[model samples]
Target: MKTLLVDDHEIVRRGLKQLLLEAFPQAVFGEASRVPQARELIMQQEWQLVLLDINLPGGSGLDLLVEVRLLRPQAAVLMLSSYPEEEFAVRAFKLGAAGYLTKSSVADEMLAAVNKVLTGGKYVSVALAEKLAIALGNPQQQALHETLSSRELEVLRLVATGKTIKEIAAGFSLSEKTIATYRMRIAVKLGLSTNVELARYALQHHLVD
Candidate 1:
């Protein structure tokens, strides 16, 4: 089996590689710390599975997921993030991820998720399953954050965590002006006027820490 791991943290990649190696001893692994490096490896090789970090330094992993789908329709792509399932699982599915798992998940769960995807099945965790059930049962009761685009939601989360526009821009490798635009859009969508309002709303809805 051929697999690729894309994450900014070298320790995370090393740790996950160890876990995966335990499960599939013969698996050949590739590591990338940024989107560009991942993209280059994707273009050059065919992978059976790609474990993608949703938040990347130079680009959003969601963006890379779309590209991966186009580049290798048969490749199984699983989204891995530190964020909650409510924050990104639905969007990851919409972007063609075979599965979405939080970094806190147990190694066994991770292996099962990877195996499910390898066999051409979708993997949704118990937590995400419950959220999906709730959303389906109460479609009209969706939170305001649900209405925001993925990028807008990301910016809002950063704002909620007390990150300034400059800090958010640096984290996303985007311009401060672009982040400001996203912040404005988030404000408009959430019916909130100030950054404080945004932060309060996110906290109230449990969108961020």
Candidate 2:
């Protein structure tokens, strides 16, 4: 199998590559530090699996996953992110990722996750599996953040982190008006009227670090 590893950190890329090489000695591997580089590599070669990070330079790994699904329908993508699994795993799965693993996971678990995806299976940590099951069993108990669309959730996270609309617009390369519109929509969806309320809600729900 061929694999592509995408991450901004060189040390992480190197470590993951070495781990993958040890786990699947015959598997050909490639690496990229940003979405554009990864896109170039994808256009030039076919890969059986892609190990992606949620945070990437220039673009999000979620966006890359969408593009990969469109460009290479058969390639399985396993997301590797520092974000909490409960916060992003379901979204990633909905976006066509085959598996989701957090950065804090052990090396053995990482190897097992890669192997599971390679063999046409999905992977989630045991704790995450239990949490997912519980959430499925009780719809009313679901987190409010889960009700938000991916983009709205991203906006909420940024707001919770104390980013102003202008700063967020600059960070996302969007217009301030556009970000303000999103903020209003998010407030409506979450029953919040001000940034203070939004920040409080986010903190109460542990939505931000």
Candidate 3:
């Protein structure tokens, strides 16, 4: 099997490579540290699966996932992130990721998750599974933030975390005007008229830590 590991951190990529080598000795693995590098590698190779980090230096992993789905329809993508499962797991799945696993996940769990995805199965941590089940069982139990677009949700999250529009724009490498637009859209979607209200809603829903 061929696998690609995409992460910006050298230590993380190295550690994950070592773990995969131990678990699947016969698998061929490739690593990339940025979206452009990953994109180039993807075009040059046919990978069976991709282990992706949600945060990259120059681009969003979610954007990469969309491109990957189009370029390699047969390749399974497992999203690995430091963010909490409830924050982005559902959105990742909806965007065609095969699974979502947080960086805090145990080694055994991570191995099992990769194995499951290689076999065309989805994997989520036990705790996240329960959360998903409950959310599915009762639509009303779903977090309101889940209704926001990926961009809006991101803006809401940063806003709740006390980032100003300028900071958010710098963080995302976007224009201040674009960030402001996203903030406006988020407010409109959630029926919030002010950043304070948005922050309060995010806190109430646990969107911000």
Candidate 4:
């Protein structure tokens, strides 16, 4: 079995390799820490499964998820994140991820999720499932932040976490002007003028750390 671990943290990749090795001793693994590297690997090879992290350096995991689904439709992508919000999980499912797992997941649960994904089944934690239930069961309960596009929402999260426009632009490989435009667009969409308000809104909505 060929599995790709796409996370920015080397330690996380190492730990996951070790954990997954217990169950998939014979598995061949590939690792990528950035979107470009991940995309190159995705285009060059076929993966049986991909454990993708949501907040990649160059782009969002959702972007790579879409590309991976297009390029390697047979591969199962299980998203990993520190954020356990239902919004993120729902977006991943909508973008064709096979599962969403938090970094705080227990080892057994992680293995189970990987097993289920490999077997062509989706894995959703009970916590997330319950949250999804609330969201799905009550469509009116959706937050205004849900209306933001993936890119805009990501920018907002970064801004909320105290990233300057230049820093965010650098990380995204986008022009400073473009990043500013995105920030402006987010303000217009969310109707929040100052960074403080944006930060408060993001925190209240659990969009940031």
- Worst ten-residue run, lDDT, model 4? 82-91
**Most accurate candidate by TM-score:** 4
Candidate 2 C-alpha lDDT tens digits along 1-209: 79999999999889998888887889888999998999999888899999999877665687789899899878889999888888789889999999999888899999888888878899888998998899899878877677787667778878887989988888779999998988988988888888889999887775666
Question: Which model scores highest in lDDT?
Answer: 4
Residue by residue across 1-209, what tens digits does model 3's lDDT show? 79999999999989888999898898888999998899999989899999999877655788889889999999999999987898789999999999999888989999999889988999978898899899889999776678888777777878887889999999778999999999988887788888889889887766665
lDDT of each: 0.89, 0.86, 0.87, 0.91
**Candidate 1 overall lDDT versus native:** 0.89
Residue lDDT tens for model 4, 4-116? 99999999999999999999899999999999999999999999999999888888888899999999999999999888657598888988999999899999999999999
Clash pairs, candidate 3, are none
Give the C-alpha miss distance for residue 117 in model 3, angstroms.
Answer: 0.8
Could you give candidate 1's per-residue lDDT for residues 103-208 as a string of tens digits?
9999999999999999999999988898899999989977778888878887887798788999989977889999999998888888998888988998887666
Q: What is the Cα-based lDDT of residue 9 in candidate 1?
A: 95
Q: Rank the candidates by lDDT, best first.
A: 4, 1, 3, 2
Residue 71 CA displacement from its true place in model 3, Å: 0.9
* Cα RMSD for candidates in order: 2.5, 2.2, 2.7, 1.7
- After TM-score superposition, the amount by which residue 13's alpha carbon in candidate 4 deviates from its true location, in angstroms, is 0.8
User: Candidate 1: misplaced stretches above 4 Å?
Assistant: 158-180, 203-209
Clashes of each: 0, 0, 0, 0
Q: State in Å the error of residue 27, model 2.
A: 2.9
